[model samples]
Target: MGKITGFMEFERLEEGYRPVPERLKHYKEFVVRLTDEQAGVQGARCMDCGTPFCNSGCPVNNVIPDFNDLVYRQDWKDAFTVLDSTNNYPEFTGRICPAPCEAACTLNVNDDPVGIKSIEHAIADKAWEQGWVQPRIATIKTGKKVAVVGSGPAGMAAAQQLARAGHDVTLFEKNDRIGGLLRYGIPDFKLEKFQIDRRVEQMKAEGVTIRTGVMVGKLPKGSRVTNWAKETISPEELRAQFDAVVLTGGAEQSRDLPVPGRDLEGVHFAMEFLPQQNKVNAGDKVKGQIRADGKRVIVIGGGDTGSDCVGTSNRHGAKSVIQFELMPQPPEQENKELTWPYWPYKMRTSSSHEEGCEREFAIATKEFVGENGKLTGLKTVQVEWKDGKMAEVPGTEKVYEADLVLLAMGFVSPVATILEGFGVDRDNRGNAKATTDFDGGYATSVPGVFAAGDMRRGQSLVVWAIREGRQAARAVDEYLMGFSDLPR
Candidate 1:
């Protein structure tokens, strides 16, 4: 987009991260950003194709070519403007999103895709460095109030948009901090807490009231913030107090393996293990911190959550880490022509795997064996997929030594407590039920109540959550004021 022959002339270059040996010592972000000159060269690799599939691939539909052109010219401020116009938090997506945009890049049909994510990262970082990133206080008060539940990317985006549209927005969270999964579920090695903190600060400055440590409806003992209000507010109170309500509470119900020794001490959910380490990294004094040091960790899942456990256990100096997946291994290389502008089925070995991990595919845990209420090992069996179902192979059972068994199996649906607490209709998959069609989009069966993000649409990427949040804001605004200028 920068030069007529730019794509042909320049080779793509990506930002470098620190060496794993050095980075494994601590949990700080190890990613090395591209220099302005390097980023400019990468930007020049954009072909500006007749149709940019990157736009369709990106959940928020970012103007990839325009931003690439602006970065090539070193107009970082404008780049951020263009990026922020679509994405509410480029910083989050820049770090953790799978970047379907890159997979859908036209350049990938032949060679490596243009470094779109890195460029977006560079633009956002430069904007903040130059203090160009600022809160947009509403110019006029709309005199309407809105209650947004949860402070994850979705809730944050919805709150910011509604506030910018002059709504008195109050974002509530049960946790002591602001972010939902971004605060706790995500390990610090991938994304530091300060990233969430910085964005939360901006949201606050933009006229959004972030009320943390305040659980809606009923909370079990020890769930309340010690310094905040003591009692839980009913859903009826919230509806009465606010002009509209948006439920962005994330899907947090972790799927568990109901095998023998499921209730053992060392056997834990990924959420239980991941959150404790994150809290410790944030300087909290956890009484019994989850540690994998000198322990054989058997992580039962092969997705991002399992990879995170591998990385965390490596950082904890674990004796060994083994990951198991129920599905058979995918082909390493996809049929490029067949999968060319779409996400293809292929095995993805993460950076954590690079650190150290024994990956076992098509393996399912059969039973957890333990002594004295503590998990010690697990029995697994290899299976093959046939006729759209898995069939266990005869004589495929094996015992894997495990001092700690982390069920990294993905979440099933939104945690029922809060969703049920609000009495909202749910889909068959247990997510909040809502439609995205223009007429009453995001509106739940409950009047004046809306749902979006993982809570509404199962677990997904941060970028999708942001998109849902922004669109849901427009829906809420329209429901309140009869029309909304907020971008969908």
Candidate 2:
């Protein structure tokens, strides 16, 4: 809208990355952000589509066109304002989100879409630099207390919103620090920890009480997932102490491959391996941390987590890194005609994949071959999908040597113990049972307990988690006061 023929005049310019060799030596963000001039040019490419499919395509329903127009006009502050209105953590999403909004851009039909994420990143960074992002403290204090269990994006969003709504909000985290997955699961090479720490400080300034190393419920014994909780508060205590409780602990149960040799010493879940590196990057001393140095590492699963493993392995100076995908390789390019205005299925090569990796698609592990309680290799076979069923190809069996195997399969659901502790019903998928209704949405079968984010919706993107958190905050506000003015 800022420039009528701007879309035709400017070609899409993507953000650059540091050289692979230089970046691999350290764990730090490598994305080169767009300069103001570059961002303005990218903003100019936003077509004034009537429908604005990108808004709907974004999980948080960001005002894309408004921000694009603001950027095009060089109104950086207003651009940040529009972006912050919808997304509580643009820095997080701008760095990691796959940018489905771009995929749904109208210009994508016949040309390269606008660089929306880069513009967002620029806006957020500029906002921070200009001191536009500051504490929004509530003037009036409601004589009510709320407990948010989990310090991930959903819990953080809910706590901030509720606190701003004049309610006393306490955020509990089991780990020693805030930011559930973002602080640990994601590699620093992609997202630096200081980004999360700055937000935590801002939340504190906003009057949200943060309690780290505190578990709201008991963790199952022998749980391998990370937990540094020094004290556990019973669910009954939370219900008795707080007016309401929001469960945003996220799905921590990592899916496992139950083939033989699963108990091998070298076999580990991606969670176990990832958190150690994050902790190390944070300058914490970890005992017996898992390392890929000089090891033939095999990462199973073809999702973001697997890609992360590949990157970390490369950083660890692994002997060789190989990734296995059970599904067939997707097309290099999606058919836009059939998939326009929606997320398209296509081959995605992450920065980690580009660094170095041997990717094997449509391969299934038959068995883990090991000796003396240690993994040595994997017996796999190529698989094909026929009639909606997977079958191994005849004479396709092969074995690959491996010194270590990391299971990067996605999570199945939240740990049942926490949900059961709260006496909340679970969906068929084992997530906490809760709805997103305006009147009483986010409320569980229990009267005062509620759920949101990955805990209620199963594993999902961070942007979706923030959306659920904000909507759930409004639901909780309405539940408390019989009405709410907070935006959903």
**Top lDDT model:** 2
The per-model lDDT (C-alpha) reads: 0.88, 0.93
In the range 287-312, model 1's lDDT, one tens digit per residue, is 78778999999999998988999999
lDDT of 1 at 312: 93
What lDDT is reached at residue 23 by model 1?
86
Clashes of each: 0, 0
Error of 1 at 49 (Å): 1.0
Residue 359 C-alpha lDDT in model 1? 90
Angstrom error of the Cα, residue 193, model 2: value is: 0.8
**Error at 295, model 2, angstroms:** 0.7
Give lDDT: candidate 1, residue 229.
36
Model 2 scores what on Cα lDDT?
0.93
